[model samples]
Target: MHSQPSNEDRPWTPVKATGTALKGADAGIVIMPGDALAAYTAVAPGTARLTSSRPLCATGPGKISCQGIQEWTVTVRVTRP
Candidate 1:
């Protein structure tokens, strides 16, 4: 929950996150951010591993109130042309 990134510095990396089921689905899924690289095993529904090639996009610790949620946003040093 704690990171070393400050507002002056951007934190970016290949992110892999895991979620558990809380309701009818019994599991939650990690939706890949649009501006990052594709990670494998996105179909698992309970866990996700997101990778990035450039600093084009950052994610938020977004969450759903009723279903529960968390997200991470980071900036990368790599850039894609």
Candidate 2:
């Protein structure tokens, strides 16, 4: 019989944003670079998945004012060609 897996056994990976930016005035939104891999890995046959721990913040005029420390996570998957 197959054994159940624990959270520690999950295949989730950690990723970070290379940059962050605020977009739009009316609909101001925070944007950041998701998961990124080497060109070789990106061109592989598998899919990449990205997941953020929390919503990014948008500040400045006409945007959501946010302060304090915030964190997020991004995940990606790559396969061999």
lDDT per model, in order?
0.32, 0.35
lDDT of 1 by residue, 15-69 (tens): 4443321112323455344322323322323432333233222234562223222
Model number with the top lDDT:
2
Off by over 4 Å in 2: 1-41, 44-67
Per-residue alpha-carbon lDDT of candidate 2 for residues 1-81, written as tens digits (9 for 90 to 100): 956433233222333323222111222443233322222134444444433332234334564544443354444444443
When summed lDDT is taken over every stretch of 10 residues in candidate 1, the lowest stretch is 18-27
How high is the lDDT of residue 24 in model 2?
Answer: 15
Candidate 1 error regions (>4 Å): 1-11, 20-36, 43-81
Total clashing pairs for each candidate: 5, 0
